[model samples]
Target chain A: MRNIKLIIEYDGTRYFGWQKQPELRTIQEEIENAIKKITKEDVKLIGSGRTDRGVHARGQVANFHTNSRIPADKFKFALNSVLPFDISIKESTQVDESFHARYSAKGKQYRYLVYNSKTRSPLLRDYSYHVPYTLDLYKIREGAKFFIGTYDFRAFMSSKSCVEDTIRTIYNLEIIENGDLIELKVKGNGFLYNMVRIIVGTLIEVGCGKKKIQDIPKIIESKDRNEAGHTAQPQGLYLDKVFY
Target chain B: MRNIKLIIEYDGTRYFGWQKQPELRTIQEEIENAIKKITKEDVKLIGSGRTDRGVHARGQVANFHTNSRIPADKFKFALNSVLPFDISIKESTQVDESFHARYSAKGKQYRYLVYNSKTRSPLLRDYSYHVPYTLDLYKIREGAKFFIGTYDFRAFMSSKSCVEDTIRTIYNLEIIENGDLIELKVKGNGFLYNMVRIIVGTLIEVGCGKKKIQDIPKIIESKDRNEAGHTAQPQGLYLDKVFY
Candidate 1:
């Protein structure tokens, strides 16, 4: 059996998420169905992680074992031809039999976009969170510094997350401003459920002066979900890259 | 009676067009219904111009005569509350009774976005035209310069256009490249039907070496629709601004 790795990109606006649900449409289900048509095998596709509904991806990684003789790279073109316009395979390659999409990943990067303007943008409605308030970039940058480094990020995760380990190392976090858009980029060893969105929400509070920049450390130390700000909407979050 | 002018924005993905067609969902129909709900008046909504199906708008202007006592500016907020999420009123103000939406416009600006890359981007799928071939930016820039100035644009318009006068003055036409995206911005006193799309198509041909830069003048002089390149798709065209 050959382990094939695929780099996927999808607009998650109309999807339930990255995982397969019983009845609802999902990114994983669509790709798997496309594979079945191409390889004539009921392959089990394993994604690096799950992205929530309305969350987009640019470099999401997935792996599947198949016995077909199709060249690895050709899978990108073949699958894209059958897949819906919203989902596409950016790249594909053959990997060692032991390689796993999720377990072998060393780190991941995520980006959350916010349209900070008095008026909402029709072009960006699906891709960005529109905040019709002036955000203080200086305060946002100050708060972002606290997220870097290894720590127990229990406070940033959703309460519904079933994962036992709450500890994670954030390698980098930065805020980039372009015109009326604010982008929050974060790289971490691994993220807890809803961790990125919650972090963005907290930072937005800091940017708007609702929360002090110095309070971020205390919030992280508290390790309580309630202590953090509201979870930002899923539409603004994107899986930017997966490092292996 | 007051003539209320509105600056509008919309994602045209799900809309048929800017015009109100019986039994068809359109931007004008939606706004007219919203107006009826707000003021209980069967008012006629006139747009600055008709944008084809799947064409977006950032600053599309429209006007309507109403006798309601509701403040002019408040119409923006009122209409937005009832309009679909894809449509938004950016600004609203009272104009003179003689101000007509279509006839009184002095100029218009349209922008066409092309994603020039080997791989298509899911994020820009709705807004940009994907062209995988390598294009010569220099050739496109050269071709654009020929389009600046007054000319009879019959060759660049759709054959279906019924207007007798095809002469229009192009104030500026520029090609801007940012990363993998190419922006074609054109400002003109008036445009023939499908004029901008056809111009973009011809320029794309020029960039790809399919058509020479010197052929543009002949295409314009021919005054035949068949003389120009194919009309580019509607999704990439945006009504950027409408001048009074």
Candidate 2:
């Protein structure tokens, strides 16, 4: 028996999510099936995290156990060929028996894309939130600065979330602009479900003059979801990287 | 009747192409239908150029005649509300009676996106071409430099294209990189049918060391299309902007 770790990428548009659910198309189930077909053994793949429908990933980590003639490094190419075009294996390596994709991760990074223009771009429809207003970029930058550090992010989490701890440490956050595209990059030791989306929505409000950049600290202290910004559209968020 | 010029954006994935075709869904037909819904008038939009099926557009130009009560500046907002999210009007302005979308355009810009990495990105399945091999950037740049002048691009067009004059000025051609994303941005007065894709395909070959950079000028000088590289996949090419 051997364990394999994979660097994964996926377009979550047509998927139910990362986890397997009955009668639903999922990233996890697909990867498992691909491995089963190759190894003739049912293998359970452990993913770094779950992403909601219509979200995306650039570098998601996953691991599985298998007993097959195929080498670990060769799994990337084999699985990629069998996987759907929207899901791919970037890299695969042999791992210890105790290695777990989700449990062994030290931190994660996410990016939310916003297209700030007077009109929406069809080219970016599935990948970005369109805001047809003048954005105060400086205020948004200041707001991003406020998010860095340890905080109880209960105010930013969705009520539907089932995580145990409300406390998380955001290591870094930055808003970068490239033409009309603005990306909100955030890294943290842990995230509350929908925390990134809520942060993006609140920061956008700050950019649009509906909220103050300095108000984020107060909202975090309040520990009430209503005190934070609205949850942003899911299509704009991406799991950029999962660090181990 | 007032003539309105529009900066249009479209997801050409579902449409037959940019032009009107009775046999299939078209970008022109969809926009016309949206206009008829609001104005109760059948209208045909003339686009700056035709794009192939499964292609995309970021800043396509088009024009139509309307005597509707909606203001010209408000046309984009009004039309966007009714149009599919994948097809949108980015901007609109009342144009002179003599202005035509196709004829008045002085130049056009197109971009071909390539995801250069060891693994394919699932999110970019339809948005870019995935090349897993490491690319030699300097070699690709050298080949790209050959395309930056007025020249007859007869060798670069596909046989299916029907254009009498192949002489076009390539004002600028550049390859830009950001992380794993690489964009081949080219602005020119005009392009031969499949010219951009052919150039991009050739550049990729050069980047991968499949072809020599010095051979590009020789291929361009040849009048036969067979002398050029194969046309790159259509999905990665975008009609980025049209200048009037």
Candidate 3:
């Protein structure tokens, strides 16, 4: 048996999410079906993580075990020919039997894009969150600094998340401005469900002067979901990179 | 009655071009419907040009005669509230009674985006044309210079175009590279049907060594459609600006 690792990219606008659902279109289902067509094997494809509906990904990782003898590098070309235009296999390679896509990940990077303008932009409607109000970058930066380092991000997680331990280490977090677009880049060992979106919502509140910069520490210490800001919309979020 | 001018932006992926067609979803039809909803008047919307299906626009110009008492500047917000998310009115103002969107235009700038990568990008599927081979930027620049100045560009026009006079003055043409994307910007007093797409197609041929750089002038002089390259796809074309 050969273990194959795949680097995937997808525009998740029309997809239900990364995971497969009965009689619903999904990123994983499309990829798995494509693999089935290529290898003629019913193999289980595992993703590094689950991104919510409407979330995009530039470098999502996945792996599967198959008995097909096709060359590893050629799988990318083969899969792309069969996959939908919105989902593409960027790269494919053979890995050891011990390799696991979800467990072996070292870190991941995510980017949330926001379009700050009085009027919404048609070109960026699906890719960015439109904020009509002017955002204070200084306050946003101050709020971003609070998310760095290791901490229990329970307050930032969604109530629907079933994960018991919410401890995670954030390696870096920064905000970048490009014209009218604002980008929030976060890299961490792992993320809880809806944690990144909640953090972004809280930071936006600080940027807009709705919340004080000093309130972030208290929100984190509270460990209650209600203490944090509302969860941001998923359209602006992108799973940028997955490292192993 | 007041002639209201609108600066429009739209993602043309889902529309049937700029012109109104029977039972077809079009940019003009959408705008006219939105205007009817706001003013309760059936008005004809004149667009600066007829962009082919799947061609985007960032600064497309249009005008309509209306008897509504809404302020000109406030028309933007009022119209955008009723328009679909894919189309937006960026600016609105009252123009001179004699001004017409199609006839009074002085110059127009169009941009063609090409993704020069070995693999197609999922995010740019509808926004850019994907060329797998490496394009020679220097050759593209050299070929771009031939399109400048006054020229009778009958050879660059599509056979289906009904325009009698093919003479047009190209003010400027330049090629810009940003990472994996190549932008071909062309500004001209006016353009014939499919003229920009044909020019881009010829330039790509020159960049890929399919055609020699010295053959450009001869092709232009031929004034025969068969002498020029094929028309590029409409997805990469964007009506960038209109200078009155």
Candidate 4:
């Protein structure tokens, strides 16, 4: 048996997510259907993690075992023909029998885009969130420094999260300004449920002058969900990449 | 009454089209709904032209009359609040009473994007057409020469189009290659129904080396629908800009 790994990309606007649930159109189900049609195997694909509905991914990874004769890299070309235009397998490679897509992941990177302007953008509306208010870029940068170390982020975890460990190492957190768009990029060893989003929301509050740059430390120290800023909307967040 | 002109942009994937059709979600209908909510007016906002379903726009223009107390430019913010996320008024200004969105335009630009790769792109699936084969770029340039100058493009018009005069001037026809993407940008005084799409189809045929490049003049002179290429899909086309 050979394990195949896939680097996938998708527009999550029309999908339920990466899991297969009855009555819900998910990326996983669509990919599985395509695979079944090509190989006639009812193989289950395991994804790196669960991305919420309407959250896009550029480099989502998945793996499944198959006894098919086709080359691993050729799966990208074969699967794309059967799948809808919204989902695509960008790259494929054969893996060792011991490799697991989920368990082998060392870290994950996420990016949240904010389209800051006096008016919302038309072409980018579906993909990014529109915030028409002025954001203080310097203040937001100062607040980002607080989230760059290992901490118990219990305050940022959501009630719906099943994560047992609230402590995680944040390798990097950056707020970059590019023309009219502001991108918040965060890389962590592991994230609590909604942790990245809550961090972004808190930073946004600081950007909007609602909170001082020093408030992020206090919010993290409190370990209360209410102490954090706000849970940022899901539409702006994207799972950029998962490192194995 | 103040006549306000708008430079608009939208991702038309969710819209029926630019015009308001009964029981269908149209761009015009959404903008009109937002206008009615703000000014209590049931005015028709006239667009420069109709874009078929799944078409996008960057600088499509529209004009409407209103007696609202808000300034013209501020309408961008006001209307965007109630309008769908995919539609945006990029720029708004008060125009002379004699100005009209459709009639005042001297020329308009349209662009169609194609991804020429063996593996389809997951990020731009909805935004571009995938042609997973190698094509000769020089041949396409020869065929596009026939589209320059002027022609009565009756053969290229769709059967569904309702128009009498098929004569239109083609100001410029350009085929540009950018990375993995090929962009077909055409500027014309006007276009007949599906004229740009048909031209694109013919150019793609030329690019694929299926049709001889120098045979373009005969194809146009033939004025037979069967002589031209297939109608390109609407999803890859966009109204790039409108010239006043």
Worst 10 residues of 1 chain B by lDDT: B117-126
After superposition, which runs of candidate 2 have C-alpha atoms over 4 Å from their true positions? none
TM-score of 4: 0.79
Per TM-score, the best of the predicted structures is 2
lDDT of 1 by residue, A105-125 (tens): 999999999999776777888
In order, candidate lDDTs are 0.94, 0.90, 0.94, 0.89
Name the candidate, 2 or 4, with the larger TM-score value. Answer: 2
Clashing pairs in 1: none
Q: Each prediction's Cα RMSD?
A: 1.8, 1.5, 2.0, 4.3
**Off by more than 4 A, model 1:** A118-120
Candidate 2 residue-wise lDDT, B1-244, digit = tens: 9999988888888888888888899888889988888889888789999999988998899999988979999888888988987898989899999999889889999999988988777888788888889999899888999999988899998899889999999999989998888899999998888999999999999999888999899998888888777788888989999988
TM-score of each: 0.95, 0.97, 0.94, 0.79
* Candidate 4 CAPRI grade: medium
Q: Highest DockQ: give the candidate number.
A: 2
Q: Specify the CAPRI tier of model 1.
A: medium
Model 3 reaches what TM-score against the true structure?
0.94
Which residue pairs clash in candidate 3? none
Give per-residue CA lDDT, model 2, range A97-171, as digits (tens): 999999999899999999998888888888888888999999999988988999889999998887778989999
